[model samples]
Target chain A: MSDSLNFSYTVDGENFASAGQASVQVKKELRQLGIAPETIRRVSIAMYEGEINMVIHAGGGVAQVNVDDSGIEIVLKDEGPGIANIEQAMQEGFSTAPDNVRSLGFGAGMGLPNMKRYTDEMHIDSTVGVGTTITMKVNY
Target chain B: MTINDIKNYLDAEVLCGEEFLEKEVFSACGSDMMSDVLAYVKDQAVLLTGLMNTQVIRTAEMMDMICVVFIRNKKPNEEIIELARESGIAVLTSSKRMYEACGILYSSGLCGKAE
Candidate 1:
């Protein structure tokens, strides 16, 4: 258990029901790896928020996690309509998500902030109409 | 309150995790918004949400929540139930609306204790 491990999943952009599957898997795997509950929780929460963002905004995307003794890193890449304003999106309660996404209890504009809150580091790169990539880390 | 007390208080049906009924929960929060629950919830062992989806189970899991009480008699699908079962989160349904259910539990001394 001295080496790093990597896990990847393709987020089903169209299906909101299946959104958190990858984060759940990561949580289980981290637990089995004997990661502390608090660390596992932080990583899982951040990743879950990112996963939901992928489904709601980007039309599905790639989620990759790398775990090691030092920390865990999560990378989410999406090709949906890219974020036009990252600053605006980071503010709590500022949402551009449509009515349907709001009904399901997301798009409250807490996604990015929640991700940032739970992680040690977070970075976002986006090109409107191209895609968005979010990288977050939770250190062990 | 122990999950059993919540069950008794709400007259809710147990959807799963009957084995966990005796477990105690310190605080509870009711919200249909999963993200709001995630952002605002802390050390709340029970989640009362009407939103029926796998994300509900996942949100509970993320918060390390022990129980989910679906208000307004909203029943989760089989997948959500299975997910909750797997996550070791107890599931229950209450006919009472969100306000009434939370009110009952709050009056019974369950506050979403600040962390």
Candidate 2:
């Protein structure tokens, strides 16, 4: 495996069913590269949560994954109504998603928390009515 | 328990991945909330949920779950089935409700992974 590999994906918010495609691809690529299963699981879960959040809140976004010898980094950027209170949003059981999304089995307010939990490092940047960018990293 | 046993026990209809019927499952989790599943980690487990969507399959994939059982007689759409099939995760549907389904599995010795 190479020391570093870069992967980019464009997430479409128009289709809820299509969310998590980027995470799936990253999982496959990591498997092919023979990364550890635990590390892969953490990366994929963090990325999947980010991907779902992008669809549900941001109306779609861009995902970039960088795999290297030391670790994996995932960056999710979206141009949508930014998070009003990062502190409140980080709390478990707090959600702004509509009832419809909840019915689909998501919007449990665990997305950001799970991302932070699974990744060794995480960063969130958002501007009101502008956009949000989340960076997460999981060490191998 | 093996996935085959789950199908027979729940009278579930196998929607995909028949080839994996013999695979062993050590634990199981029942939830419609993907976040809850993400909050917990399991090994070689089966996910039982009422949520019939792509995120369910994706959640199972992230957890390395080998099987997904949809309760309440709910059937997954073609796209969901396709996603599960591609990910090599078995999909099953049962007429039992979520509580009954989890109860049966628990009594049969299927438990959630330890923290």
Candidate 3:
């Protein structure tokens, strides 16, 4: 084992059903690397939430994952409508997702909060009408 | 409780992961909203929800849940079952409603809180 390993993914915006595929793959990879179950769960949940947000709000994105002896880092970048109010968006129940999205079992305004909850550290960069990029890390 | 115990107690039909019947789960959460489930659930819990969708299984997988029990006799489609099987999550369908199903499990010693 090296000190770190990197994995990258291109998220597709066209299909909602395939949103979490990248997270699933990352989870499998982490498991194969013998990361602790709790750490894997945290990483997978944060990444899955980010992936879903990318599809629902960002219209698509790229996810890069770096695994190392110290921790796992996930970066999600998208070129969609950026979040206008980071504070409001971080609120648990404040959501701008359409009703159609809610019907699919997401858009409950818990995405960002969940990401923050499961990760040890998180940072968000956004430009309204331009895009948003989220970086999250979970320590092993 | 073991997955098989849950199936027997709820009179549920196993939809997938039959081989995992011996697996144990300590807690459970029932919700239709996947967001709430992911936000609050803990390790190795069983997710009992009425929501019949592939995302339900995906949510369970992300949370590292071991089983998903669909209440109201709601049966997930083939794709959903396939996804659950791939994730090694036992999928079960029960005729009981959500509240009743949860109550049955709660009283039967499957506390909803994570350890």
Q: Could you arrange the candidates by lDDT from highest to lowest? A: 2, 3, 1
- Which segments of model 2 are wrong by more than 4 Å? A1-3
Q: lDDT of each structure? A: 0.90, 0.92, 0.92
Q: Candidate 2 lDDT, tens digit per residue, A1-140?
A: 45679999999999988898899999999999899999999999999999999999999999999988789999999998999999999998899999999998888889999999999999999998999999999997
Best by DockQ: 2
Candidate 1, residue A57: how far the Cα is off, in Å: 1.1
lDDT of 1 at A57: 82
Candidate 3: C-alpha lDDT = 0.92
Tens-place lDDT per residue, model 3, B1-115, is 8999999999999989899999988899999889999988576799999887788989999998999999999988999999998988999999999989999999999988777
Q: What would the per-residue lDDT of candidate 3 be over residues A95-129, giving only the tens digit for each residue? A: 99999898888999999999999999999999998
Residues A58-95, candidate 1: write the lDDT tens digits.
Answer: 87899999987789999999998998989998999898
| Higher-scoring candidate on DockQ, 2 or 3 | 2
Residue pairs with backbone atoms closer than 3 Å in model 3 (clashes) = none
lDDT of 1 at A20: 91
Between candidates 1 and 3, name the one with more favorable lDDT: 3
Q: How many residue pairs clash per model?
A: 0, 0, 0
> What tens digits encode model 1's per-residue C-alpha lDDT throughout B1-115?
8999999999999999999999989888788888888875566489998887788888999888999999998888898899899999999999999999999999998887954
**Ranking 1 against 2 by TM-score, winner:** 2
